[model samples]
Target chain A: MRSRRTVDVPTLVREAREGSPRALGRLLTLVENAAPELREIMAALAPHTGRARIVGLTGSPGVGKSTSTSMLVSVLRRRDLRVGVLAVDPSSPFSGGALLGDRIRLVEHALDPQVYIRSMASRGHLGGLAWTTPQAIRVLDAAGCDVILVETVGVGQSEVEIAGLADTTIVLLAPGMGDGVQAAKAGILEIGDVFVVNKADREGAPATVRELRHMISLGDRTEPHLWRPPVLTTIADRGEGGDEVLEALDSHWAWLQEHGQLEERRRARAAGEVQALALEQLRSRMGSPTEGVLREVVDEVLAGRLDPYAAADRVVADLA
Target chain B: MRSRRTVDVPTLVREAREGSPRALGRLLTLVENAAPELREIMAALAPHTGRARIVGLTGSPGVGKSTSTSMLVSVLRRRDLRVGVLAVDPSSPFSGGALLGDRIRLVEHALDPQVYIRSMASRGHLGGLAWTTPQAIRVLDAAGCDVILVETVGVGQSEVEIAGLADTTIVLLAPGMGDGVQAAKAGILEIGDVFVVNKADREGAPATVRELRHMISLGDRTEPHLWRPPVLTTIADRGEGGDEVLEALDSHWAWLQEHGQLEERRRARAAGEVQALALEQLRSRMGSPTEGVLREVVDEVLAGRLDPYAAADRVVADLA
Candidate 1:
């Protein structure tokens, strides 16, 4: 609801790029709000976008996702990389519990100016992640982050949606959790670019890894040109296997570049963003009745005088 | 992809109404495939829909959903009402294991001509249940099903989506599975018209029921006219508590009638159906580029010559 005239977009973007954390936070807040100034902000930031390599980590509730993310953030920092962490949970909606817990676990890097962390809840915006995520990623990308980790406390569809925003998606699992079958059932296997079986010292780590490998082999991406995801183990709490995970990420990135798939993926991501935006515009138009549009149609539908299909047709025709 | 000429929508609809199960099955198949004949089929069946009472039953995997549904179907049959059962697994896409299991558990009614059961897999269809269910419900309603039980092997968002189609939603839960918190988190508490603690013979049934009531009490539906859901316990495998569930359903239906909620819910369902169909049409039009619409925009996006927001504006403007 913030007016466009009150906020100066160019100065904010400049300050954000010049390493003012307040400006960066304000930009992301605007992205989350889907405010009136977002179009101007995005237009200003468009030139600086597409620089950050986004890595997404997703798993079920107790798969050590945040711990692994924190561990990975530490390792990335050790390698002198400025990192931005976007923590989102698809299942625990509208509540701060999950995002708060995610932040607390990663509190180690809170003081580091190079490490930026923000938690986004996919509560009631409908697409959960989609409506705000792509724009938020552009903000972080423009803010000079070398790598942005999109970590999600996800259960089902949100994980897949998160993968759409990421350059490389990591599916995290833990030992002895029936994680493999659950992972496949959730469709995480198809979206994963790198697989990590965290909690390596736990009972069923090797078995989980073996099951994942066997399933990956059975996948239809059997052509030699495709990247076969390596299933690695990590005791992330103890910081044991961050190096291997990072190595896998680098290899996937290299393979993406070698096959010219990075360009392909980026284009697809952009197309998704464009399509989502167009849909949003169309949906908003459908909502606002301009001289007897949605209101009359809904009334007729309620009276059974107009079937819903016909009602939608009327709405769409009136979208001009 | 069957040709429209081959499928006579009128004949199929007539046969389905006259109790031809094969015709009913074929109609549902058409819905599932989203065949070209769907619009014609929907128009033909629209007059007959809004008749059957749709009761959605949802919970986690081992909460005895199919068994409870079968029990309810048998009870409805005892009252000499034709029944239809739709079994779907939102978590399981492109496979038949869960649906097969659902069928096996409901095999007791397979021999009854009055009871029709169909299993739908939400595979590859982007909207899953949204694409197939409304029309499927129409087919079953026109097929003379007085009651339709929508049983789901749901985990996350599908549970919420299924509630949209139902007249009265029943959220099933087991006693010992942290069912209360999980149900609230999965958003069943808000949608459930009746909460059933199934498998009541378990050790913690009382505690689960208490927890559910506490949560229900905490919800915002405190108005005196609103229907407060009762927490019921069921040992469905033994066929116990079916009468109580049926009685609760009857009371809720009466409440819906007295308060005119049934009409509102049906209209809302119609509106949702209308919106989904409209979106689908728009998306298809977007996909099939006439004279270089999406292709050029995507190419520009890939080249970073145009930002996705501007590209979206261009696409929407080109839609005319």
Candidate 2:
């Protein structure tokens, strides 16, 4: 059952920790596939992950996600911090093959040893995090990367899911993307820990930012936090005002810590991680021996000899 | 710990069956809450649910979901069938109120007893289906109803989940959403058994239908079935061309029958319904004695006393 291209867990973990690009690439593949050896790899490098501040950048397609991500990387590196970027793209609708074009726009930083970038796609997986994105972040985090930026295709639900995976969630909006703000109403707007009004050089930037601030204010009138998520305006292509964006994020993080929201968010995230791991294991175990017992109950339900709900209860009871 | 006001489950079930709206309303409320008595009530009503052809109608907002549903009700009544519509709306972001606005737009059959419309919101339930929506559908489906339509707030994931609850899924789309035929990428497009090009009086009507047809052709290249999803055009607001839409649907349904897809779809839908029920029960059971067993393992995980993967193995082993 062994595959020819096996992952070298220990060596890859060591190299990834030493900032080896090849090692990081291999580890991301392992994580994306949910390979059986993922735990061994992650455990070997867990010490390095806590150092990275994971920032998720998401917005509608035309809102300049990659540009903002690049700007953030440029700004963080100016402070002498190592930055890693994971830009997620949607696979081709017809071919099912991904076009890793996000990294092409960020190719200017390819020569910088302090910067690392990887582009990932949904890979036909449903439950949120691009299968490899989280693993890649763990690898980069363990590699002593000071900052990790996750850029997601911002078509709402997936974007919100990606945003949830990060320590700091940045929802980007651009001027003239009118429908973009309305689309945010679904669930994305609620997930924004920090909002970025990117492409601030354009018209209606002030109005768009004001509108968002007003909406947030209206959402929670009686809450104590009174936190109007700062809308930092930036022209990412020009690298103008990138420092202020980082400063605003730092301020938000500090405020969250002071309010104890940071601990609560982390706890919820850990719970989600645990649940996801449980579900993944459960899905794989569907073909295991226990499932044979469950199938017998299902057969009874199918034959109309027993109620489906009662049958399910019996199966779970048997498992218990 | 019991409340003073206990429910009369049998009487409510009897009244609900006898066309008493108040009793039906009360029953729906209980189901929405998934009260302790839910299992007994549903078991009593299970025999009544098999007759209705439950259809789930979904798409992005402004694609005329409510209007299309109104047209559908009109078509069903013309054929002398009793119809019920359930509109699932999420709570208002600010006020925790139901918009219920989907009902107002369906003006054509407002006076028909054959057409019953109900609106339910998330009401703090975590799963996509408004807890009341499915339960209400079951009640209506059992009460000699011929067709049941479930319309979800066009915001993405909830609608897809609604499709799983429906016997046949109709995905509505407008001509110029500017989604660039990436329209089908949202996972909703993939699940559509029938596609409707509403607002077909618009300029891009033919082109959009052609685009969709192309997508469908690409999807079914490998598997040849007698049932091909035909594209239909409609101007639903004025009820213009509603008959043609119905014709296309009938043909599609007949094709499904001929190709055996109809029975397959129903069997799959039933399985999904049962699984969703099981997941809901498991979710509600969280923090119970069942969860108390897992909590200890989770605590060990958070404390770093045990790794998550190892803990998952133990939990599964314990469950087995």
Candidate 3:
């Protein structure tokens, strides 16, 4: 085991690129920490990015997300492609506990050098899941993963964010998880590039797929050549329908590249990442609440002597 | 119909405090916009706040959040106390449609002059739902609403945020909502001050409450004096158990005051609001993508010449 103090970023990046899992894990940790050497590592890996096909899978809980993800990994591995999985759970603080379960589920890939799986908890990070996920994807991409799968439980702002990070976003649904109206209310209908009705053997599977298709037809498709999200059925636990899902994903990627949307999407992703990082840096530089202008303003706001808006103005003026 | 350009802050504040619903609505709109006159309005209303008891209601969709909120409003008004409701839907862009439903359910109080209801959509705002919510609460507090209820769907980061804004947070669950495990997974179990199993007439009500109690017992209570969340049953549709719910809220409020936690909570809330506003101001100052250093840095990032972290550093250095 390398001591924390002795771990070197350049060496780790090189080793990761040379297919060392330990080195890749170390590099991921560095990126997750937004380490001091992040700039050096990212600059080194920039030339190697934009090669991996990034796919995001998200849906409500109990939708067989884990089972579907595991099945997808198996299918991809069957083709001898290097695959990486980042299972991000934003609500859980017990990363170790969830990771153990994930490991058990993906036991087949546990010893496979070509398949890398990791779980990231959203706690203890200054920039929630959104800020950390892209960097993690970049590390996997640079480490030569052919297809990187990013899966998150579809609830909250994180689901929308995963859409921005992935080249193709697959939204999973299960029978009796609620009707199509509920899905629309959750805002998942808008972000999905492809919808999967997992557990197709269940009673309401056909209804769920039909509901999704109906909702998609009703959605705003103002773009002349907008991609219509396909609703597919899958019995993930039985490892059925993986081929069809893969076909849909590949078709989406092809359409994106053919329409020149791939560059546009990546550029947008890069811009968002840059903007978020810049904002986080500014927040960090504002310093802690010990004895700064920020603290003073907070004190005033707390005392009700100054409004939050005015206090914010003072802090901004002082910093700028 | 008052023109936006001619709305006077002092006059509006005075009228709102003097019991004019129109003035109160206008003040809410102003605060929601983070208008130029926000400081003046907040300073004027500062003395009037901390008088209203703030209650937050959150639960999964189909868990009767809207019905329960209306029922709670009825219960509070029976005491002849004025009430205000802010239905914050962070996912929707069509605020007007949702507000119409709220108004219909609250039609009994539509002309009551003592009850006010508004829906805020999270769109076109730099500061998200968290930042805008407290100011809106302040408007209701200043308008002399004896009780203010803030309701939000309990799926995302917003539920945690609502806990910070409310003096008491009620987490509602209905029967067959996938057991208590789903509640725990949603991260609501930790933040709930009081848990309510709504739709008590349903088949699985007792089991749901039992599951909640079991989960609560298993929760880690590091603080010796930590408050134990009480699980209660309620048929909100029929207004059953409203008195017990009210009593629980009152008891919790008393506990907070006796333990001297009220001041600490309010101070923390104020600090958070201040911090969020300051961050928003900084982001705004970074300017739009059309021009400025921010745009230049984004261009570099998109071109892959400069990594996001380095670009962020340059922007921060330039601004600071």
Candidate 4:
């Protein structure tokens, strides 16, 4: 493969596999930019990806998503497992990019070869998942990381979208942040595969936990898959109770594997790759010269001069 | 115009203008479904649209957006101004169409001839504003409405995109919805032209307002046109202080008009129409025969045989 002197994909991939921080950084940038050889590189790397246990973290802003992720990464690194983090930042309206200052919160991990952290800008994707997210995850997974954690952009709907993308989703809630119970009512309570009462040291902690436990108990018990999604309490900044968090992760992974759900999830993720490629291909093809015929069909449909179904059929025939 | 047996666009538009509830209901459905000739019909109806002051209500779910918009509409109706409401809802994940049930909360306007309401689905667009929105605005705008209110889906970057569309964007905030200040810190806070401390009857109302005011005060003060935006208090559910909300709206609109910014804003909105058409055309062109060239490009790119820019240029060249 043709490679630039400054950014060699093979060298970067190899170094990242060997736990080189700078190489990991370069690899992440290539993935985010959707580099020329992204698909081929990612395809080559897919076999290595299924090994990493993916964790999804989500909550409203200032509920300490970055801080909690940092502590969790530290705990994973301490266990001697290499970790990769993908933190998704909400985009800025003026700049059309993410204000990712949250990355600075994890500066402690900068020198730790075992930990690789990358910030991803949401880039106006509707679902909380970034448009490039699944590809980014594949890149991290192929780079030989033990665990890959994805942090959502902290809006309720985005939290739900991110939950769907991960094997285990943690919905973070804080005490005294106002409307803790209301947030639960608005869909966060339903999407969480695991609930984290973050900043547990704050006032109203017990009440929030008690309320959450009560809510969880009230939920229908029709789908128990070995481990019940637990409500864990932690003061993330102090690195307290992170071990319990790890236990929860391991238990959830084990539960999925024991139930054969892991394979199901992997199948779904693989299917997503096909859909992404189809969408990309579809978008690119829409602008071709042959599009003149389709443009006439659309104009006629909009003008009531042509039937929509008939137009669709004609286009399909033309494709054939 | 060739008229349908059950619903005729011109009749519906004319009757809806005369404060007919059934006519408004039928018209909204036509627009939301993006009925044929909508663009032409809307352009024909633009003059009547100038009467209503459009206000955009947005925030994440659980922030009381519907309640706030309902209250604001109620307050406007009390002043005898005809009000039209558009609530944008998430399209069904499975069906790829919007579930209009989100508007169930705002049915208080159902029997009022002075108020018209419609719900739009984003149809899997992710966070970008739906294609049907502006036309729906035009249909309501033309049918002799006094004020048009657009309520966003309140998820992810939608709040910011919606802000750009509305004449006056009022971002609603509830006291207890997690990270009181930080929720406003991301893309949401930056785009809001005006802030609504919704659920002001709640305990943390004063603090939320103070915090918002502080942030507004600290922002760049050089653009007097973008002066410290106002933060208003409202118990939207109870219809309390909504008159003050309208007063703020009046003042904000007057400010834009006095400085000749109103015309500029309208001009930008006009330009938005052409951009929207392009996007709509793009969606329609997908899956058509013209996509053959795009498929070839993708094949080349996927095989790591062609650069993305080169592929993109080839497609653009065909269009030329």
The per-candidate count of clashes, in order, stands at 0, 2, 0, 6
Which ranges of candidate 4 are over 4 A from the true structure?
A1-7, A91-100, A103-105, A126-130, A224-227, A288-320, B1-82, B87-112, B117-128, B131-147, B153-156, B163-320
Clash list (residue pairs), candidate 1:
none
Error of 2 at B115 (Å): 1.2
* Per-model i-RMS: 3.0, 5.2, 3.2, 9.5
Query: Per candidate, chain B TM-score?
Result: 0.94, 0.87, 0.92, 0.87
Worst 10 residues of 1 chain A by lDDT: A90-99
lDDT tens digits by residue: candidate 3, A1-320? 34567567778889999999999888877776667788788888877887889999998778888889989999999899999999888655323323545446677788999999888766524435667888999899989999999999865566777888898999998888774448555578778998999999998888878877887888896577999989999998899999999999989999999998887778668766777787777777666554688788767766667877787788777777
lDDT of 1 by residue, A95-167 (tens): 4323575467789998999998888766545465777788888888899999999988655567777888898
Q: For model 1, what TM-score is found for chain B? A: 0.94
> What is the overall TM-score of model 4 with all chains considered together?
0.65
lDDT of 2 by residue, A1-320 (tens): 34648667888888877878878877776775667888887667654545677788888878888888888888888899998888766332222333565556688888888888876655534354634565667678778888888887665356656766787889999988986578556555677878888889999999988888877766653477745577778989899889999998888778777888665555455455555565456544333322464556544443445444675466456444
Which candidate's DockQ is highest?
3
Most lDDT-accurate candidate: 1
Q: Give the alpha-carbon lDDT of every model.
A: 0.80, 0.69, 0.80, 0.67
- Which number leads on TM-score? 1
DockQ for all candidate structures vs. native: 0.36, 0.20, 0.36, 0.10
Alpha-carbon TM-score of each model against the true structure: 0.89, 0.82, 0.82, 0.65
- For model 3, the docking class works out as acceptable
